[model samples]
Target chain A: MSARLACFLPLLASLAVAGERLHCVVIEVPSASLPLLREEMKRAAAPVADHGPVLLSTDGLPRRVTHRGQAPFVPEKPIPLGNGPREGSPAGARSFNIVAASGAGGGLVYDVSIQQSPVPASYYDFRTKGLVAAVPANRWQELAAWNQGTRSVSLWHHLQTDEPRAAAGDELRIELIFASMPDDALAHVPEYPPELTRQVVGHLSGTGRVWKSFSLACRADVPFHLQSSHGDRRRRQEPGYGDRVLAKFQGRITRDTPGHATLDGLLEAPRHHEGDAEAYPVSSEASIGEWRLIVLRDGPTFKAAAAAFHEIYTRRAHVAAKVNVVAIRVSVADEGEP
Target chain B: MRCPFLSRTSRWIGSALALTLAAAPARDRLHFVTISRGYDDLLREEMKRMAGTPVLPRSGKLLTGITGFPRNAGYQGTIRLDRDFPLEWSVQRSGTPGRTAGDFGFTLGVMRAGDGPGLRFDVDALESGTEHDFYRMTAESVPLPLGRNTWHPVAAWGSEYNQGMSLWCYREATAVAASTATGIHLLDVQVGFLPEPVVAAMNTFTPEHTRLARGAMAPWQTLSVSCQVDRPFSISSAAGERAMRGRSDDRGLCRLTGTLTQNYETSFNLKCQWQPPGGKKQPQVRFDVPLQPGRWHLQPVEGGPRLRATGPKGEVRVANVAAFRITAAEP
Candidate 1:
């Protein structure tokens, strides 16, 4: 009811019996990693590649859903001791530094400091991977939405880890990053890309309900623009499709992944006495449009999640569960493929 | 419906009953919500009302309220300024971590007898005779509401004793800021509870070295400084007058070689004078330093022989090192 009380209520609920294990669900281990703790999934039936991040929803969630961005590990303020040689990961790599949230389940989001990793070769956000955020006015409101039973962040990211015997067992790591909302973008969104609010909710085509909310944000500005190639047209294009119309939406389309993108949604954009055209164009770095929120939540035995994904896409959406982030290992092909 | 005569008699009986109820006054109760400060992170809070030292966890929020104001649910407390100059508000709540932590910054809000929630005092906003000197926050007799829906009256202050140079208070609801002068170092700030005899206990250390600025001294030159007691207060000291002293070497390796007092706010004043390497005005950097209380170290910086002192938590790091800008090697 009160801001103070409301914020604490969920955390309290989480603390109560938060350390429970459900019935075992077998899933493929990172082929490189191996079979999880509980049961095992046949590699043939559970294609790890098809599972992606969206399937972790407990149940009651659609299999195929899109998310813009999901942050797994974020602290109100990160204490940077700034000690030298204190950077990077445990299995050790140097080109980039790793920021850890180990004690909490979330694996550390890599921190790309200008001093350390300047020209990073990541899968998304150009070379850099993360973005800074502004405080939002409605974090409480967003949480209320989750409480109201319409949404849950579990859909976007769900992970469980069956740690080695030396490490503790039954440890689950779920990473989630949300913002109040950004100040600059709130003013900027309605004007330049007037249809973004409607577009994200799938106003154009390929419609679906919001599965599990990945980021509950207020005053959040997660805006980006990606221009693919020439001849990739938008909706209702008249005879005259010039370079300016193509360039106008240059930074409008955004895809954040280390792999190929294939957006499957209706496009919303300006057009004249329209024919069979999308308002926004389907785009990918290569042939055309295909963008989805590159959020990935994994569990130790992600088989149940993989199965859940199959259930959602195949036309069953009554399951309910909160997913989390265990570890997401993206296998990227050569850069030009996307 | 009674007849007119009967109705008149009933009215007389009702009046007599009303007089008896109004004669007895309701007992006033004062419950409180206390916010804790200086925390590493959030933790779970268990509530207890009677203990004098209500072992509050550092740096979090707590709000507790009873049925009435002042007597039953209220407890009195004092805020001693820590070296970090932290200032924030405290209120009681009934839910979640069950508390709300709001950063009042160097300012504070309180509701005393006449003040409720809307009134606030911006301590840093006050200046003495001209509004530019030291600012100590205190309370006023102004009554205001604490929350939007509850228009209860209250008297409040930030965190003041009787003494202060001056204080500025604003009722958040009225949107009006007011200033009151208390001339005493301690000021009274009230929100909900008025804890009497509020005393601040803190360490007040004096630095032996002068403050360093950019480009004034040669890169990486070692300098020595002395410390002496300039002021003392509620803080107890082992070395009565010995201000905690230390030094920095050419390589910027600094060690505070004294059994110095803990938690004292350390600062230094800067003035320039010429000094020859071995003269009486010789740099103190090379001297065997004993941190005797009330002892002064004549420090010389670029203005003379370049004197600098390093405090307990040496603010000097590769980050803020002035010389780093010039001689710092490019990695």
Candidate 2:
């Protein structure tokens, strides 16, 4: 199948009644080559009718998923796709199924099952058990380790309970499949670029799935000396400096989903290394060792993006003895399309 | 031998004439004149009543006159004096029912009457006593006039301790032929205390006698003095002193400018000093001028020893002998 037909097949299969309530099962595909995968799926005669994958492609097109015997439901608004899966319960009632498929490029997929329950419950309640059960037996050990680790994942949940019910008091269940993880999927992890530090001040350039083009240039200066008191033995032994950093990001975002975006970066300094010793009273000398620009999103407005920058840098105590995000500038492309 | 005989005879004749003249006694006559200048009939009657005699002229080798001297209201008296000779004079309170204790003074002097006249002799007697103790005595030469019949001021006296008395005496050149009185004459007599020099100075600047406004720095304020003094003196405000020079008109007028700088309600001591034309001593006179806010007028009471400034609200006298007041103008 061609890339366009592959993107449209999920929409054709999921046509359903607008007001009908039903249980849903969701599966996440980890792949940037969603169009190529669609050709393979067609040749293999996979069950695309009952389990059509919702492709979140870089083309910025909307995809739909519907239940049997129901009319097609199209989203009235653009949905943001790259971050994570979205799930919610209705009035203490729980519903859903989830499954994640791992890809060759170390991209993990999540599978979820949802049931139409009378009382509302959170998906976080079954995070460990349900997720562990959904994984293939051979990958169970790897999934368990990832769950136990400190790495963060990006997942989004959105719940809508206003639709009409098929029964007088019966709750509805809806299923959704998220495929084609964006090239920027790794950027969604809360603490990305782990153990990776860039220069104290440098330029950042990356393409976003939602925002087609992205570039960030920044210069940071240590305006004040960060001295730890002698009474604070830990800080005295490991002194740090505070900094005032300035950053500017320019990019173009899809016009339909325009809103505020965020930029996150990391700053790190080394502690004195003693000879074969883990700790010491004081280090010989220290400097800002690294700075990493993890993610930059085109926010709705420049002011909003700058405010987000200020909010992040001001609250961190370890960035320096003191830290200030002095200036921030964000400019949106005037093309108005993507 | 013959010339000696003639000289001895002439000497004997001159010696006999000298002996005859030496036996004669010196002739001195005391004359008195009654002054009617600037007096009313009521005052003359009051003076007559106080003197226990009619205000009449007494003629003798020494003429005596009973004249009315005006002081404050209810203070009028008779002054009895020898017209040409220096003599003693006394003023005993009339044993009247409403008589009040007061001060009085008498001044007798002889002065030359001419373009460049001068006082030859002057005597002054002042007393602040009751009916029994108030009296004055002076023996001075009568004033001589350089011109015939030229009237020259001779005596001046006043009292305001209890009741007011302002009296003056003048000698006409005719009096010089009547009696051999050759001494200083008093020119002006004021019964009450002298009007504060500053107050008098301000009065010359404006009849309203308005006090300078506090912090009034503007058109310079100028005062002209026409008193009898001959030399220039100095006047000062808080801004400091400026010398007052005599006007070119030779009217004995000294003009002073009060350059005001700031608001001052305190007493300003205006000092004036000058040496007599040919005298070695410099007499310095100071007046305490009280400064307040308002319009003022110098009120010289006829009898009292208090110089007062009458404003729209009321009157204020120099309460302290050392200081007078300057009040603010009426709004």
Candidate 3:
């Protein structure tokens, strides 16, 4: 496809949605701040950890997967966005939160108290905890600013939920805040979001897949020396890994055949693997091999809704290595009728 | 029982078709693939370990004609017989966020072992990671392939730990008749601070302070560098006047052209004007980078300075300065 045409395909797809719309927000977090963000998220998940649904973090990915052969693992540049939710799940009735797909953990999270699917209305009432209550849907754009230092609930990105009201007769409402730009301007939004008023670029549907991606890269050089029979070759070097995953996140919302909306995403993280010490016995090469840990939701975005919390601690150890992690969060928000 | 004349004619026609098919040119898309590393801690330890023991080289057999430390640097060229040479090539650690010893480049080309003719490449391994004057280097077309390339820039006077390099590749397929086998190009001009502790007082407000202190004497770090290119284009105010000329090659690749040169004294004052491809004169963007020895601090302009231009076939951006070394080539 022509580059210009490909750039507008998302905008065109978003404009085509008639009944329900998907709202998403993407935030670029300095990779250095990810650990603190994860810790803060864990604290938020504590209150609802056992009783209710909690957001999924990178703690759920496999610790390691060795490549058996020498062939390079050229991972596909992930499709910006997915398939619908699984059958049996009522469409628009659930939302899933999966963070740091490659096991490097993090997600754009507001509060851990809110359940993944069918968020309890009481969870939005932060006033009970002596914090500011969730802003009414109209002022949601005010919550869009990224605050790396905030300790409490803040809007990570605006997402709408279509899950039915709780049995307690309370409704969940999140509005789609349109970005202030014509369709032609959508392509440049991500690169220059600060120049504009909103980061919520366009809207998708429970069945219509749309995503926003961001890259967070960090690097520092290290010195190493290789001992050879003739002489020792000493040189300071940087890890020669390319732009694979400083970190990659794709937030997606998919609907089941039933039209239920779910908020979920994939996070690709750099898994720091010590190089093969036996082969290069005299070199620090063993410490430089980096693999990717993908925290992915295989079948449906909502399956791990309630199970995401307890698993966070188990996966924490896997992410201890300081590697690249790119988080793309494709979230959902209700448009409030037509 | 066929007639001899008819049979002969059919045979001749068949031979002609075979020859035509064999001679048809293949246009393999071209892009840049760079290999580099940083001087980070893990590498440092690796070096120390190497000094302690005898480590056998881990790379595969090196090609006979190729030169440089390809094997030691972990450059494994075409491993298996690739029937369809995919255009998207992999780049190694080219744009690490920080320090490195240095890096170089070689053009790796391949053909379907016995099916096609041999490949030709012009390799420059000697000047691979050589550094040049910053402004002089930016004025040249550092040919890199389209897609993801690395940008590793260090302070001029910084330790060898912070050096970076830019490189390009050129490949020629003797059997392929199409020029699309040439390459694509993008012009990325970045000017930004070298981060703190490395330098002092070159902050966001430094530009304003320069105007106040010297009245009109703009420091290299605070000067609004102008850039312009020879093409049909649209530019923002922030693009300093640097000339970039691009045109479509036979293979439809937007090949960038032109190099800026000057006497020693004139080199310090960077400026350029352009009459775009269509004979219309757009605003001129000038880049006045200081030539004082040592490190040069660069800062981003307010309101996101960008110079977006449309070449005959592609668009190029001479945008805000970032820490990167771009080596453009056709491979």
Candidate 4:
């Protein structure tokens, strides 16, 4: 009895891991343009696949299609396909259908049912006979949320060619849908911290790419807000109309060795406007480090500040120093207007 | 004892003859005056008092041949009529071939008193023939309606062969009933050369059509305009249209510098013209080589129009020829 229980325990653990579902998106493209799509996809991080049938369980959930000869049938109504073969039909276990329609121009359109599970590796294999690109369920959910909040997401397929070319007749079309977040779950999300909100002003020094890398760690109790106001000044000074302020902040940097560095920061960008005195905290990490800050500014004020900072840093170490001003404003929350 | 009716007719005829002789010299020496709105109440009374009266300064010569009009009223005190050519005066128009004529052209900068069709005027030049037969050379009549307070520069030139002629810049205030009461007020006036025909053409010339290339190009575009002018001028782009004033050059070539966008349309305006020296018979041509975003060059097309652009791949032609749009195409 103990030996049998041990084997069953391993099987139960595998089922629990496999049960973890992710959001799966399927894109339909012309079979002929798969090669071109593959070339373009190399620039981005997405897995591509071809045409095939998907299996769904009794609860209308996507299940792994184990056999090739599963009942490939289009149901008039959504039905729960049993786990195994039913009394009469041998393929009654597989439900849901991949409906194909004629797309505008000479292309095929497929109505793919988004699966709740992470797409298996076999789905991306071209040898498995399906054409699609599957994004990890967590990443897909984050992208959808970001797209809903900002409305800045754009999707288009580009044709790869050496010479100047027009849009290809047969191209891939990707459609993304954002799932609404529940109000109760959203309450736990923290608002952007005001402490880190500041206009960073500084300069860069030392030539030749071999400059020493250093980082300034923030206290665990307090959140550090690093922002630059250079973008705002540039927008205002630009001539003509349609001036737009572009603000970008790279959160964290990861390094495998002393010289080699990789930027791995999650971007949490809120809509930025001119004179909006608010700073978004870097991350949830208590102690943030492993970043080399390079600040560049011109004029007498910057020069004097840089010289003063350089004198202090050169005394301690052989590292170059940069002077930066973090302009922070205190909010008068209870102040009444007259 | 004498005939009473004959004596009365002879007395009336002798008085009329004396009045006609007195007005003859006043007609030859005409005064052009410009008044402002500040003197509106005193306009009619002043006009009546100054009529047929010569207002000559005590000293200094009358500025007959001055090009630009004086801005201040104090300067008018220093000028007097030329003593030698006091009766026979000639003023040369500025910026044109100085041709002397007997008559003077004046511009009256007047403002309307009320909201009504202010007035209309007919100007006629008195042409005296060799046999003493006089005829009137009338110019196009202009309307000086209320709210339209502009200096309408009109000219009345007699037959080119006639030597004895006088220019008249006149306006009639009787056209409108309201204007007849207030009368047209003359602010300031000076006799000078008749305005050149080129000046009139410059005011009226509007580019109704343009030819440019459409679609995308590697870089650059060329613009050509065929117009008639007598002097050097420039054509440039303004407010998305070719509306900038170009540098004056005898070469009739204009270099336009501006940044261009991809898949967008821009407009240009040709403001002036350049006429080559001793090339009056030659057609007026204005060429604009716009330096847009990328490298652009005028490709030499054998026996083709002078203005053409070449791109990195091939030559381009003006796509919408009538609308003036240039498009990239294989040469």
Highest TM-score scorer: 3
Candidate 2 residue-wise lDDT, B237-306, digit = tens: 1110112212221121112212122223332222232111112222223322323322232322222222
True contacts kept of 3: 0.00
Could you give candidate 2's per-residue lDDT for residues A204-314 as a string of tens digits?
A: 111011111111111111111111111221122233622211111111211122232222222222322333222111111111222222222211111111112233466
* Candidate 1 lDDT tens digits, A71-154: 222343342211234222222222212222223322222222212111232111111123222211111011001100122211
**What is the two-chain DockQ of model 2?**
0.00
lDDT of 1 by residue, B1-331 (tens): 6599989899999999999878845322222222221110010011212223232323322222110011111223333222223234443322223223331113243333223212222221121212212222222222222222111112111111112121111122222223321111110111111001110100111221111111112222212111112211111001001111122111211211211122223222222221222334344322222222223332212222222332225533111121111010000
Model 2 whole-model lDDT (C-alpha atoms):
0.24
What TM-score does chain B of candidate 1 reach? 0.16
DockQ of each: 0.00, 0.00, 0.01, 0.00
After superposition, candidate 2 runs with Cα above 4 Å error: A1-338, B1-119, B125-151, B159-284, B287-316, B319-331
Please write out the lDDT profile of model 3 over residues A10-45, one tens digit for every residue.
Answer: 987665442222222222232222322333232232
Docking class of 2: incorrect
- Place model 4 in a CAPRI quality band: incorrect
Task: Specify the poorest-scoring 10-residue window by lDDT in model 3 chain A.
Answer: A64-73
Q: Estimate each model's TM-score.
A: 0.18, 0.19, 0.21, 0.16
